[model samples]
Target: MSKCIQGLSLGVLCLVLVSTISGALSHEGSVALSHEGVGRKQNVTYDGRSLIIDGRRELFFSGSIHYPRSTPDMWPDLIAKAKEGGINVISTYVFWNAHEPVEGKFNFKGRYNLVKFIKLIQKQGLYVILRIGPFIEAEWNHGGFPYWLREKPGIIFRTDNQPFKYYMKRYAKMIVNMMNKNELFAPQGGPIILTQIENEYNNVQQVFKERGADYVQWAGNMALKLNTGVPWIMCKQKDAPGAVINTCNGRNCGDTFTGPNSPNKPSLWTENWTAQYRVLGDPPSQRPAEDLAFAVARWFSKHGTLVNYYMYHGGTNFGRTTSSFVTTRYYDEAPLDEYGLVREPKWGHLRDLHRALKLSRKALLWGTHSNYSLGHQLEARVYQNSEKNVCSAFLANNNTREAATIYFQNVPYYLPPRSISILPDCKTVVFNTKKVNAQHNARTFHHVKDFSKGMRWKMFKDSIPNTEDTPVQNSLLLEHYNATKDTTDFLWYTTNIDVGSNDLPLLNSIKPILQVASWGHAVHGFVNDLYVGSSHGDHVQSPFSLNKPITLKPGKNKISLLSMTTGFPNSGGYMEHKIAGVSKVLIQGLMTGTQDLINNIWGHQVGLLGEKLEVYNPRSSKKVKWVDAKGHDHEPLIWYKQ
Candidate 1:
């Protein structure tokens, strides 16, 4: 061959080579293979009888771990830990706001390198379950939807509304197209066998009413049209419509609660809330490790072929992403803490439990389950294969603080309080939730430096203080706008008011309320330079409310309300249009029955001057003076004593 032809042919051959390896199936089966690069989609089939991986029967175990929750440097270690815990697949939701913070712009570098993440999983000999929720409600801010979508006029989320559908389809296509280029689907020989759409829609189904169901069906249709050759799933969606497999998402998911409308589909647990979330002002909510093991063993004994722990490792919320409804600290008490440290007994105990479950893979993946009551909240379930050659058992005590010993086939098995024991061999008890055999490693947290002794401080005039002449948007009535990919929790509202001594007492009489309907990541109020109040709402779905009646005296009073958001609302009905800035503020009894300030021309600013200067960490600022503020945005903003 000529040198030119040889080079051209060589280039084509290299392209083909990458495509072939990138899209290789796990098992030899009928799943079609795509000649695209890794991350492409291929048709996949699950015939109720078997997963039919590449046309062959296979058993799979998966776990959930969000990428952004942990640093990219920690991915390999986390994945290794998961594999050690008997996981054959890694699952994650592609956070929308994290990827496309601004409209039409995309950032997949560094920690957001999703393609790299998937490739890393494949390297670890595991499959991937990509949940492209564009609308993931992972207790995250705004449920993972982009803030920019809210900017669109008349846009309703998770509905049959045209605007929502258009945006949803657009995002879906973007993902599919990106993956297609890489051939990430099973047919393409990549590890991705399953993909999901619209996370836990069923959790909020009642809120959608008729429009919700229609929206779900529409989402399903759009997913199918993508034809990625993988089984599409809808987690916690009861009304998922035809061909859309509805999967369970919770601490315990069993086959007993199969969807009435989709009986033909297989039962899968997409999220197993292994450990609960802990918040400040509340007692820790740690499930005894034994209970988690028991739950898994129960699922296996009850013919559950697939069970995914909601958070195999709940990593840190980090940066400004720490969401809260009230002023409470949230700790998941998971296998891993925010700092990437192992969560002692919980982690080790569950690791052992995974081993016990894996030992009974044969009986679990293909067996008939039968349950029998052993009395006293004690229950026994047996899984026997078609040939009766494989047998596994589970003994559970449902009581929160009781132990039970049950006889199975004349054999006695001891189960601890609120625990379950798994016997893969039907002879030896391997895993139990309540009984802990692992070492407990305690955690300690200390402030970097104690401010009790006090430190030197300085004060400077805030360039962007609540002042007159600031620009404000005029809205006669309440209006909510989307983030439009602007991820900052900050929105500025400035308005001038003429007040006097008589007006002040009148305002105090009627309770001059700062009724801001702000769906902020957090909210702060300022009357001129004096700080009013600040509040951080619930992390999952928190909005600020400055309901305190402020005493505003006479002479030009400048009211500045700052609404800060961690990220944009990503899920829920019309969440895209949820009000983020100061929605309503009333200075009642100013003079008449109600002198509502809703009609005042309000100046709007997107973010803080410090943020604009990229001054996230004050320690690194040599030129800037740091001062300890008595209270954050306190009324008559007090400077901390130097």
Candidate 2:
């Protein structure tokens, strides 16, 4: 049978088993199904060996799928595909910025609906791992923090600051309370089995010095107090507090990985990075299927009971949610691509590995483990269940370029370079990482339609008023964050400069240079409503100077500067004080000296006129009608309303 059919069959069998178990335990005071078909509460605990769910040891296989990254329409298919890929647990980071973009005002509808996403996963009979990092650094805007948090006075983020802690606790408690109200926690019979507090803090702890350790301890303590009734985890944290399980996160964590403070806790790999995220100008990254499979087999051989892929399916980073350096397309070369297509050997090979590992769960999880080093870079790991007389073994060759023939249990097996061989019975080779039995599916792209042929276009100019007709400020220039209040990326700074008759003689002969120093991602200038020039800034807060020579009329000439931001400052110390927009402006080659246009009554606009008209939303009733236009190409500043 095909894999899909097999998955369907397995799903039906699992449902039957769940029903039988629930009915059998109803009279024993154990968990039973409710009238509404919700699962009853069950105890989940972990020991030095593995996690025990209801007195039975389990091997967890999870996959990461951020809810806000994909649309609501894609949730069911994505969850089903993950299930088909042998994922029993679905992990997701609750993006704070997407839910509370304006601070205190939360949105849970459409793509930002966290509850709906969790329910979909539960419906598929999969568990959940909730990574609630209000300060998640998933290459997200402001590192998943609302922009308004910077406006608070004396605010320091991710530290021992009182203001920061108060808000963090508020948001964290809000999420926990919301979940508790709906009984969405594991203790309440929901699918959420594990919850993570802070993410990857140890990687940059030294940046905050002493306060860093204090912040981490406080955050962990705060999460414990939430009483989610599930095990709390902190990924990539070496000095994690007591009661919080410290998990490993990387491309490959070997057998030596153990919980930081609690070594006896179950060894859990929270993030096995399937592939690296895509940067703007960098080439795409991928891992070999053989190496990935070897990593999984080796982990199981070393007695790892829980492992979660960083991204089983990396979807698109829609709209402006992308960070400063990340690209629009977030295809991480995972088992499933952005469009939900299975990535050939990686998907099938891992599925096969999962099946093979499941067959040896009895011996691996509840047996004795011993490791022996064969010659060179080859090592042999064995797991034996003396009670059941079952045995499993993994022979790994870490050598990158040379294969090794190793003798395991008096039998010779050829191990390829950087690969592993799995022996389910300890005497016979059941599967080899280098030998791929799955088909190599390839994808082909074809252009199906010419969309421009049937499209009609319309043109409209931005109706920007004069500087005297709008709000004015006497400062050099207002910061972009302060003026826009994080409402939109575009901010307009309009000012007027009057040239006397005496200056016209010199201005008419020699073009005056319009210089504006801005601290922003990009800036576009306009003189008398005509396009002047544009320039961009770097990632750091450096001043980008826009120097272009221009003609000035004898009367008042309006100068408009539009500043745009790729994303807000996400990290570093005192980042809340970082500012954007025009810092200084001067017109060189005037009559007497350089005229400073900084301190003036500058008109301000928050966003583009097209945004005000809801041009991007096709379903908006306020959308304007489009008329056919004959302009093949035009200059900048021309807006199309189609």
Candidate 3:
């Protein structure tokens, strides 16, 4: 056999070998991989015009639907919806934080069951794109790295630093090993075909510095070294090394970027954003179905082959896992809301457009192309093979709201505002974003009542006394605690010291200056049961000053702080040592000039009474005047009932 054939045959052999090994290796039952090496061995051909999948050059449609975004119960329906919308693949990011909440602990029993999720996709007869971004920054908290990582010492993230590489390699191995053991690769007849490493690194490429290049190289090498026998992709990574294929992302990419290396590598759009995420104070933003369809048309007419909708079904950000906490994680302007209801117009309009675009599959998937810019933001393109068997055409207007007419090779075409025109036969305009031909359907679900609707409430003072037991002799005597196996956001540090009559004046009038250190993303303070205030951190560091006046009742007073985290520090630079709690809580109102109380004998507490009660769930709800259900819109102690 020739070397090429031998290599190809070995590839095939490795596929079966891996699958067989996986089947035997699985602690559970055997896992399946889809047609992994078949496309390669079949001599898949492609140009600027078409993608030949399984020996046939054809147009392919894909959509993004991360399994972690929704529950397994919702998977079948979401996949069915995508297929109904004319999608061929299910793209997702394997959230590392969700999978590994603690350092060595992994829980894939429920929603974190990536294996089951992939198997479910395969059962639906759909392809899969597994984006294993140990560093996925999908508007996720701490960019999806667990807060436990932030507890580590001197561990800078996404760099060539020894600590980071150590953890990154360990995590990558855990995931790859799981997938391989289950034969989740294509060689194992599983649905996954494409795999991604990291996410949008190019968007933050400047942050990596010179080490960025080396870090990219290290990531690619580590990922490829797994020998998954499938291609690895990096989005927005224009300078990706030879081993990793760099792909595109954005509202429009086919016209703006080209393949970094071999044309054999197909054009893949990783994130075709359907709508923008919601921001505070901004009205809910949405993309009209027509504009979205027009963008797809432009890509198809330009000989683009693979297009994945950034999110065919936008799922909810359940729990604190949603992006906004201090900012606003309640972003639900997706094609589908957090409740799984499809957004109007954009959903139906895009559905019909997907069907129409599919009709041009042959012309789009096969023919080579030529482009003609008709000027004035209007462009034209023609695609066909020399055999004269297949042809397609595209017309588009870049203007946001102006309509135009342009003659392309003697054929008059009408371009709508910010729209694209697709012609499967180079004659008829079959799909236009400006036009809608599908029925718009709206879905809404009844809200479930509180889980703690009828529970009782009881408050007991914690036995630990106060922070005065140990008076600091100097400013440098403050202490820090590391939360190890104890992963809750709460940490308690209490000490006590006496203040004589002279010292009483300094502390009483001294504003009771207390400085605290904690890794909690959110911290609440209390002095003798009086609510001091609450301070929240951004993506990093829980640094703030409690300028509120604190009084000492003659002898001793209890000072408590409750720190909470939406999710632990999962990944970053020196993330392990990322100080989250009150790094420095100063009583600055009492002191001025150089004598500020940035440091003091601090009594720190990690969590709140509400958290210990698990107040978020109704099953833990109790009846207390200050804590019981009032109405939904009340403040402070307000609770809601069924």
Best by lDDT: 2
Worst 10 residues of 2 by lDDT: 12-21
TM-score, each model? 0.80, 0.87, 0.78
Compare the candidates by TM-score and give the number of the best one.
Answer: 2
C-alpha lDDT values of all predictions:
0.65, 0.77, 0.61
How are the candidates ranked when ordered by TM-score, highest leading? 2, 1, 3
Residue 237 of candidate 1: its Cα lDDT? 79
Going through the candidates in the order shown, the clash numbers are 59, 0, 51
Q: Give per-residue CA lDDT, model 1, range 1-642, as digits (tens).
A: 111101111221111000111111112211122224334433457755435564445555677888877779999988877776667778998877777877799989877888888878877767889999878877565677766776677887777889878988888889878887887777886778888988888766678788877888899988988958888888887877777788777666653456324546776778778766554345666766666766766665655557787777777665544333321223356666555567778778877776777666655556666666667576766665645366566777787876666665545577677778877755567667777888999898789987655665444334544534444455542232432235455566778777766655432345566566666555677776556777766544545566656666667778777676554444555565455555677765455345677778776766566655554455534455656553443323222334
Ranked by TM-score, the better of candidates 1 and 3 is: 1
Q: Judging by lDDT, tell me the better candidate of 1 and 3.
A: 1
| lDDT of candidate model 3 versus the reference | 0.61
Cα RMSD, each candidate = 12.9, 8.4, 11.2
How do the residues 45-91 of candidate 3 rate in per-residue lDDT, one tens digit apiece? 34434444344555556777777678889988877777666677788
